[model samples]
Target chain A: MARFKLTIEYDGRPYVGWQRQDNGPTVQAVLEDAFAEFAHGEEITVFGSGRTDAGVHAKGQVAHVDLARPMTSDALQAALNHFLKVRETGISILKIEEVDAEFNARFSAKGRHYLYRIINRRGPLSFDRGLAWHVIRPLDAEAMNEAGQRLIGTHDFTTFRHVECQAKSPVKTLDYLRIERHGEEIHMLAGARSFLHHQIRSMIGTLELVGCGKWTADDVTAALEARDRAALGLNAPPDGLYFLRVDY
Target chain B: MARFKLTIEYDGRPYVGWQRQDNGPTVQAVLEDAFAEFAHGEEITVFGSGRTDAGVHAKGQVAHVDLARPMTSDALQAALNHFLKVRETGISILKIEEVDAEFNARFSAKGRHYLYRIINRRGPLSFDRGLAWHVIRPLDAEAMNEAGQRLIGTHDFTTFRHVECQAKSPVKTLDYLRIERHGEEIHMLAGARSFLHHQIRSMIGTLELVGCGKWTADDVTAALEARDRAALGLNAPPDGLYFLRVDY
Candidate 1:
């Protein structure tokens, strides 16, 4: 058996998140099926670094899959992409390379990077309608950044964690959270060793209140200290979130 | 009558073109209908700076319209946008301002700026399928820029002009033609007072040959000097082209 690591990109609009579920198509099921086609109907299981909710895009999502048949990494990548294109799937295999069997896409992950886009304009979105979060009121990105800074460092993120999160503990080290304005859009970049379910989106939704002068930075700190899910302000939608990449 | 100038943005994938047609829906027709709804059935003509072909997007397309009834620019913009949203059109009114009665969207424009996007990668497109042109082979941006420079200044552009172009003269000055690589994508910015129909796409398609080392700068010069439509190398698809903005 040969194990290969694959870097994938997807629009995430047509799937039921990254995981395979019977409800609808998913990124994982799509990749596995594409691999099975070239593997001559050999059942293939592909493991991902993490799961992203439905409507969340990915510029670079890493995964690992083991194949019973041997083939050049380049050939396999090309073949998989060919099947994906033919199937009209939104997923694309960016790169593929051989990896040690010991490498686990889920367990060996070091860091995760995510980007959330917000279109801060009064006008409704046209070109970026489904690709970004649209906020009608004017936003103070500087205020949002200041509030985001309060969430840095190791802490109990229970306030931002989803109630249905499967993680046992809410304590996680947040490496960085930086927010900046790019013309009409607000981009927030967050990095961490790991995140609880809906943690990033929860934080962003609370910070948006600060951006619009509704909540102060002290409010964000208070919410974190509460360590209660009910203390959270709001949960940002999945449309604007993107799993940028995983760092090992 | 009050004249209003509109800065518009649109995802042109659904429209027939900028101009109104009997064949199908168009950007012009959508705007006209929206205005008519709010104008109490008064006939309103929205004149665009230039007509963009089908499947060509616009980030900053400019237009002008005359209203028989007096209304604040802001209110008019808001009403039109509300109607557009209700109709689910992929067009947005970025900005609206009252202009001089003499202002003309087409004749008064001093220059037009356009952008062409080329995704230079081996993978098939996903998120940017219709938003960009996918090129499998490697491209040399420097060579494309070098060849583009030769097209600048006043010259007879018959070679690049479309056979169906209705321009009275084939002579037009190209203000600038710049090629730059942005990550995995190649962006080409072209500026001119006016362009013959299909001139920009024709130039980009030919420059692509130079970018892939299939043609030299001298070859581009020869094509331009030939001043014949038969000498043109290629006419790029309308998918990657964007009507960026118009200067008054």
Candidate 2:
């Protein structure tokens, strides 16, 4: 069987995360159903780079599927888009490529990139309602950036780990964390080989406290050293998080 | 009575239009209901710059309302937002200013600015669904711009005006019509003191034919000279239209 790497973009609303579940609809189930149609009634499984919670959007989410039929990547992409559109789901197969069998979508990734969007405006969002986290309070993006620097490098991220996280270790090295302002929106970008459950959201929540002038860089360092979930300042909602890209 | 000028924004997906109608819900109705609560059970009427057809979003729509009770702009804004939110409408009052009694939302406007967004790509939109007009064929933006310039200045826009338009005269001065591309989106900006119904959409639709090499600048000039609605090429959908701003 030949594996095909697929790039996808989806609006995370009306989804119960990326994984298949009995609770409600999911991105995985929708993709699998579309693949099944392309596979001529045969069931197909789609493995994703990572699982994203409900209301978490993705711009360059990656996945892989092995199909028994021999077809060009372009042919497969056209067929997949046709079936997915028939389902009327917001998921779109952006592009696809044939890859070696050893290229597992989940384990063969070098790094993952995420971006969190925040709009620091009091006006209710019209076009950007579900696309951004609106914070009425003016955030100090400079302060947030300074605090983000403290979270870089190796550290025990227990304070930022979700209690329900299934990861085996709390210690992970964050390659980089950057915060910048773009027009009315503030963006928080993070990079790492892998992350614990909700790690990015948890870190972003703590940095927000610093941005609002309630916390300092040293305070963030202390929180990281605390190595306890209770020391976490907050857990940002899933509304603005985006799986930006998965590096090869 | 004090006349208050209010800057507003709304996602037009749910509303019938900006005007009040018995057929269904409207932005004016929602704002009036919120204002009625703030006016202490008294009825309130809102005057908008113009009516935006269904599915036409607005980022900086302006309106005016007269209230019997005197209140600070801040208080009025806060109260209006509170009531609107409680009603769960997607409308937001961006800013409010106390205006002169003669300041009419519909008549006092000197000019209007509109932005039409077109996504020129083969891929189906995920985040931008219902927010843009997706054109599968590649467009020649420069050619479209050249044709747009032919429609600038004073002209009898009968071919471009809607058949059911209520305006008395077909002669209208179009100050500017410019087409520019930004990333994957091509934006058409139309500026005028006023326009006949469906003028902008009609003009853009014809220009699209020019962009796709089906028409030329000379063709647009001939259509303008024909001064007949039958001469029009197409009337683009309202999904891509945005009421960007009303200039005073």
Candidate 3:
């Protein structure tokens, strides 16, 4: 058996999420099925770096899988893409490469990158309706960025963690956070070795309050100190979140 | 009556085209109906700068309409947007400006800018399926740009004009034509005071041949000199074309 690393891109709108589920289709299930077909009926398991919520997109999600069949990386990639296209799945195997047997997609030392997009305009969205969050009110990107700086280090992010999150610890170190305005859109980028569930969305939602003048940087610091979920502001919707890349 | 010049944006996938027709829904029909509702059942007509074929998107389409009822530009814009939103049309009135009574969306335009996108990759599209043209073959953008220079000046572009085009003459001057590669996508920008029906698409399709090394710059000149529709290489689909902007 050979282990291979797969770089994937997918429109997550159609899936239940990244993980396999009995309720509806998921990116994992689709990929497993495609890999099984490529392996000629052999059962296959695919491991992803992380689980993304429904309605979230991924430009470079990473995964690892083992196959009994021997094939070139290029051939495997092509075969997998062909199967995915035939099934009309929104998932695409962008690249595939042989990897060390010990490589684990979830546990390998790495960092995660995420991007959130907000269209700051009064007009309703046309082409980017589902692709971005449309904020009818004007946003102060600079203020948002200044407020976001409060969330930059190791802390017990209990206020940002979802109640249903299974992680044992509420503390996680946020390595990077930046906000910038590009034309009519405001983009927020965040990076961390790991993140508590809903942390990024929670922080973004709170920062939006600062952007629209509903809150201040001092308020953000106060909320972080509160360490209670109720202290968190609104949680940003998943529509604007994208799993940009996973760094190894 | 007060005349207003409107800047609009739309995702043209669901509409028949820009023009109103009894055969199916159209952007023009949608706008007219929304305006009528905003005008309290008053009959209204919305004139567009140009007619875009089915599945052509627009970022900055211009139009002019006369209304007997006087209202602030903001009020008019907000009213129209509310009606359009209620109807769930993928159209947005980006801006509204009170204009002179003589201003015409079509006739007063001094220039029109168009953008065409092509995704050169082997993978089948997911998010961009209907948003761009997907070409599997590798493209040489420099070659295409070099060949496009042949179509920049005034010429009798009979070979590039659509067979059913209603233009009085085939002679037209193209002010600008450029091809550039942006990462995995190739963007083609074209400008002219006016264009024959399908002229941009026709030229793009022919240039694609040059991009793939199937045709040369000399071949483009030869095709243009042929002055026959049959001499055209190919006609690109409208999916990747966007009526970018109009200058009056």
Candidate 4:
């Protein structure tokens, strides 16, 4: 069997999550159905880099699946796009690359990038209604950045992890975390080797408190050291989170 | 009664053009409903600067509404936004100005800026799926610019005007028409004193032909001089069009 790496993009609004579930439609199920149409005999199992929660979008989400067909990557991409046209599901297969059987998309990834967008304005924008976090109050960008800087680098990150997290350990390297302002919009670009369950959301929640001047940079550090789920602030809404890129 | 000018932004996907229609919802209908809630005494009539076709978005559309209550422009803006939140129409009143009694939004002296976004790529984008025109083939940007220059000067654009256009005179000063490329996206920014029915779409259709190498710059001029609706090319999809700004 030959391995095919697929670069995928999806609007996560309609998805329960990336993984296949009986509850509703998913990015995985759509691709699996499309793969079945192209893969003549064997059932194909597509593997994603990570599980993105419902309503979280992706621009460069990576995945891979093993197929029995001898088709080239280009041929497979064309066929999959044609099949996906049926639902207009807003999920796209950007590129397909033939890889060695040993290659795994998730395991081979060196890092991942995520972006959280916030629209700080009095009136919510229609175009950005669901695509961004609408925070009416003005945020202190410097304060938010200072607090986010505290979360960067290696840490246990237990304070920011979800209670139902499946990771064996909370220790993870946060290579970057920065918050910047453009017009009335605040964008948070964070990157790391990998993340614990709900780490990014939880961190953003705590940082949001700092942005709102409710918490300080030292307060953020204390929350990290406390290693308690309740120590973190409110979990920021999922509307703003986007899986920007998965690096190799 | 006081006239309040509104610089508005809306997602035009749900509306049946900007005007009120019996068949479907409209931007006018949505705003009128909001105005009715804010101003309980009188029925409100909104006069838009231009009637945007259905599915054509606007980041800077202008409209005027008169109300019996004597409210400041700022309060009017706030109240309109507050009342608009009920329906979740995805429309925002960006700015409001108290205009003189004689000022008419539709009849005011002004020019308009429209932007047509073209995603020149093989695969579809998740976020902007219905927000842009996806042209898979590689387009010649230089050739498109060369052709666009032919439509920049004042001329009779009847060839590019819609047959159903109601304008008395077909002659309108075309201030500027430029086609520029940014990364994988092609943008066409056009400005004119006034537009004929489906003028922007007709111009885009002809320019698309130029970009695809099917028509020459001279051919565009010939089409403009023909003064026949059949001389124009295809009407580009409304999704890619946006009323970017209105200059008065």
Candidate 5:
């Protein structure tokens, strides 16, 4: 079996999530169905680096597939894209590369990057409704940045993880957290080796309070120290979250 | 009667056009219906600076409205937007202000600014599907810009005007036509006092030929001097066109 790594980009608005399920359409099911045509009717199962909730977009999501027949990277990409186009699934196979069998899409990942987009404008969104979070009031990116720094480095993220997260530990090392403002758009970039479910959303929800002048850096620190889910300030919606990259 | 000016933005995916037509729903009809809710059943007509075709978006479209009942600008804006939201028309009133009775939205405009977006890359659009024109082949914006300069200044733009254009004269002065490249996106900014039907799109379509090295600057001049609609190369789709703003 030849292992191939595929980088993908997709709009998550019409999807259940990255995983396969019986209830509704998913990115995984669509990819698998597309891959079947190129695999001579052999069902293909693709393993994703991680799961993204419904309505969470991905610019550089990574996955891996094992093909029984050897094929060039270009042929694989073209064929996969052709099948995807037929479905109009809003998924694109950005690139494909051959990789060693030892490289696991999920377990071998080194780090992950996520971006949260917020449009802090008085105008309600028209073109960017599902692509960005609209915050009616103006945000203080400087204040958000200060509060973001308090959450960096390793810590027990119990206050941030979802109550139903299956991760064995609540501890996580957030390598970096940067808040940047470009005109009316505010972006939050987060990097970590791994994250418990809903960790990024929880952190952003709390940071938004700081941005709106409802919380301070000390308040974020207190929330972290609380080490309890009840201490979480908020959990941001999935509409504005994008899985930027999965580093290996 | 009180005169009010409104700054509007909308995603034009679901409407026929900006005018009132019996064939399908339009932006004007939606606004007029919303206005009736606030006017105590008195129907009102809105005069837009210009009309945008179906699927043509707007970031800052301007219009003027006359109300029989006097009200503050803020109250009018809020009520109009409140009524608009109930319908989920994918349109929003960004701002509103009181204006003089003599200020006609169509005639008082000194110039119009338009933006044509092109994603000149191989990647298929996921986030910007309807917002940008996707060209798979790489485009040379520099060449397109050079050819675009020929369309600037005063000229008989008969070749660029649509067949159904109702303008009395074909001679029009184009203030500027600029082509700019940012990463994989190419933006064409066109400015003029007014435009003939499909004029901007016609120019952009021909310039695309220039960008792909199929036409030269001299060819663009010849096409303009030809003064024949048959000499036109193409008329770009309305999907990539945006009615950016009107300068009073």
Candidate 6:
């Protein structure tokens, strides 16, 4: 079997997330359907690096597919893009490369990066309404940054994990965490070997409280030490989170 | 009567355009309805700085509303924001200030800024799929910038305007023209006292030709002097164009 690694981009607004669900359309199903057409009478399955919740966008998502047909990667990429374009699929294939038979897009990845955007202003940023979180009050950037800094390093992040997370363990090695402010917009960047379900969002939710002066850096540290899910703050809304990259 | 000036923002995807149309909902109609409701039995009208074509977004659009009530600028701003929030209108009133009785939003504008975003890559940008123009091939930024520099002056832009333009003269002063590249995206900024219909888009189309090496900077100058509408290249699509700001 020829294994093709695909770099994908998708607008998650119209999707029911990246997984196949009976409830509604999904990015995975859309790509699988496209692959089926490319295979012509052959069933096709696609493996994604991770699952993103509905309304969560991805600028650089990686996936892999194996097919019986032997075709050039460039031709396959062009054909898939053309097919997706006609359906107005909101999804596009950025690159296609033939990988070693053993290379798995998801399992071979070393780390992932995510960015959460917050529009902190008295007036709504209509241009990015659903694409970013809108907060009417001004945010304290220094406090938010200090609180986020506490999240760096490896630890058991059970407090920031979702109850339904399928990951085997809550322990994760977080490589980087930082908050940047550009005018009225605040961007939070997080990098790790992998993330537990809703972990980054939960961390952002706790940091938002710090920016609002409701919590301090010490509070975030305390939550991490507790290692109990109940110790974590509310999960921030999913509109602002984006899968930026996956490093192999 | 209190002459209230408003700065507005909108996504522009659902509306037919900024102006009210029998075909679809408009930003103007939405604002008028909200204003009329807030005024109780009093009639209200919102005047926009300029009409944005269908699917054209705005980050800083200026408007004026007339109300037969005594209200502070802060109160009106807060009230309208609250009212618009309830209907979940894609449009938002960013700022409101009491203006002179003689002031009109459209006629008193000193300058306008526009930005056209182009994603120069093989894949789509998930977050801004409908908000940007995508080009599969890499473009020459130096060539595009050279060609754009030729358009930064007063000239009869008849060749770069739509035949349906309402301006009495094709002559207008272009204050600035700049092209910047970020990652795989190309952003073009234009500033002028006023613009003819589709002026920025048409200019962008011509510049794109230069970027592709299909034409040269001197060719753009020749097209300008041609005066005939047919002398110019195609009009760029509206997806990437944004009404960035207005100087009052």
lDDT for residue B208 in candidate 3, whole number 0-100: 96
Writing each residue's lDDT as its tens digit, candidate 6 over A85-139 gives 7337878888999999888878999999999999997875566765788887778
DockQ of every candidate: 0.57, 0.42, 0.49, 0.51, 0.42, 0.49
| Ten-residue region with minimum lDDT total, candidate 2 chain A | A122-131
lDDT of 4 by residue, B72-162 (tens): 8878788889988833787899889998988877788588999999988777666786678888888988899889898888889899887
DockQ winner between 1 and 4, please give it: 1
Candidate 1 chain A: 10-residue stretch with minimal lDDT: A82-91
* Candidate 5 structure quality by residue, lDDT tens digits, B76-170: 77788888882378888888999999999999999999999998866567777788888877789999998999999999999999989999999
iRMS of every model, one decimal? 2.7, 3.0, 3.0, 2.6, 2.9, 3.2
Name every residue pair that clashes in candidate 2: none
Estimate, for each residue in A96-185, the C-alpha lDDT of model 3 and write its tens digit: 999999999899948999999999987788887767888988999999999999999999999999999999999999999999999889
Q: What lDDT would candidate 5 get against the real structure? A: 0.90
TM-scores for every predicted model: 0.96, 0.90, 0.92, 0.90, 0.92, 0.93
Q: Evaluate candidate 3 and give its CAPRI docking class based on DockQ.
A: medium
Best by TM-score: 1
Q: Tens-digit lDDT track for model 3 on B84-105? A: 9823788999999999988999
Sort order, lDDT high to low: 1, 3, 5, 2, 6, 4
lDDT of 2 by residue, B26-121 (tens): 999999988888877899889999998878888889999988888999888888888898226889888999999999999999999999989887
Instruction: Superpose all Cα atoms of candidate 5 onto the true structure and report the RMSD in Å to 1 decimal.
Output: 2.4
Instruction: Supply the TM-score for candidate 6.
Output: 0.93
Clash totals in order: 0, 0, 0, 0, 0, 0
| Tens digit per residue, CA lDDT, model 2, A155-228 | 98999998888988888999999999987789999999999999988988888889888999999999999999
Mind giving the per-residue lDDT tens digits that candidate 4 earns over A101-151? Answer: 888878998999999998887765788876788898779987898889999
Best by lDDT: 1
